[model samples]
Target: MNEGLKVFLAVADERSFTRAASKLHMTQPAVSQHIRSLELDLGAHLIERNNRMIRLTRAGEIVDRHARQIVQTEEQMRRLVHDLASTIFGALHIGASYSIGEYILPVMLADFSKKHPGVDPHIEIGNTHSIASMVASRTLDVGLVEGSYSPNEVETEVLGADELILVARNGHPLVRDSFVTIAEAEKECWIVREEGSGTREFSDRFLEDHHISPERTMTFSSTQAIKEAVRSGLGISVLSALTLQMELELGVLQQIRLEGLPITRQLFIVTQPSAFQPKVVSAFSDFAKEHFSDLTQTRTPVHRTSIDET
Candidate 1:
């Protein structure tokens, strides 16, 4: 496939031997050699070269269509062979958003690896939008995200429910309060996840629905950083309750509830409906459903405690 389409597509699209050679990472003479060989085999003048420019002749146009179809068919065939070999031993490439990757997938993956030692897992972490795009482009076998997506090209399965909770450093002035109204919480400094993050997206919607806006906000890329910043009393943030479990248990942070904001998001597993997923991916997907389905079943209440309780 590479030899067949390499020179033809490059020359046809670029219309210049010099440019096509550069695109194909081959010398100009080498590109000309391949084209000449193709012409000899086909017995046709496929291209007209003139003054540093090239155009496809009638025969060239006819062959280009067949060349493209042949290339596509070859790709499909390769995928099929790879999938077959992967049933016994294959790699699964999974893309996940920040929260799911950091707080959830490690445990799920650990269990899956123990069960299926023959499968190799490659994980990529990004924001929801980035992961979704990667799955759509076939760069990833599947994606797990913590928000709703409306992509027509992909199929989404709801895996579980995750809730966002407002948390602050222990012993903060608000920790002793039984309830913090949205308006009152908005007056405090806030540390938030970066834009495009699933937690941040939910936080923004939570704030909007509650009719409250933070007076001061700081953004951090990782949940660990945000947790550390909030632990030191830098600010408060709305984050996944799962992300703050250790802190909550250690009395480093306290969850504060606000009125009128649901603060919950549905976790989803997204994949291209038309794409073929390898056997390893299917195994992992089944493993995920078996072990992690409980995480999505019901929303848990935020636990609260004072610094003195520690």
Candidate 2:
């Protein structure tokens, strides 16, 4: 990628000269010079300033699209060269949906880094739809997402299956029984993930299956947020078992397995089809798939000791 184009991308993504400069480790004035030079060479204005806000102009949008491709191509070329030397190096753009990113990915990344220490990871955490789109767009080398997605030019392999269940704050009266019924579960306010989330999709389907129309509901965008809400006694929510390990162990939350409900969804590894799979990408994908069970395993419930008992 051209130097000016690189600077422009940083600016475009950051949407501020000051932030872009900080990201690029360059001065704001120099960053502006690079953008100005690029615009002058192309004979068009690429950005606009209105009320101290930076917005990409029409030409800028076109440039941004093509510039990303240029950068992607350059990265591939670099990977190809490094492959000839049999070295696994360079930054890896890894994307993951919220639940996996929050609860599962750090361990995977840490394990991967132990072998390929040279591989620098850049993570993008978002919902399933967004992660799949990023993988299709080549902005992400690989993505781990739950639920279903069909982005053009991207392929997915099921890494593993995950179980979802209803949960409530520890000792909440609504779940005195180890098993809960949909009728009993439906009366309380339901907390849910955002529209595009895999968890949200499952929650919606679960409702339809049970013929539920909760009287009240709340929405949250992240797994942590939903967990916090449930912990704070805002409402009950359905969530993956993988996310409940620490909370369950600590006695902060307890599972409320619904009768006849053992809800499950496939975990996926999304990647674009390419002739040359970079060593880093292949290594991480294989590692994740092989160890998928480790991430999905549910901790066995044990007796909890209270502060008084301790």
TM-score of each: 0.70, 0.89
Number of the predicted model whose lDDT against the real structure is largest: 2
Each model's C-alpha lDDT?
Answer: 0.77, 0.86
Q: List the pairs of residues colliding in candidate 2.
A: none
lDDT of 2 by residue, 1-310 (tens): 5889899999999999999999999999999999999999999999999999999999999999999899888987898789889898998999999999998899888988998999989999999999999898899999999999874568899999887777889878876645555577778889999999999999899888778888799999988999999999999998887788888778899776565354768999999888789877888899999778665564554332223332
Q: For candidate 2, which ten residues in a row score worst on lDDT?
A: 301-310
The digit string of per-residue lDDT tens for model 1 on 38-73 reads 999899999997886778899999998788667645
Q: What is the lDDT of candidate 2?
A: 0.86
The Cα RMSD of model 2 versus the native structure comes to 5.0
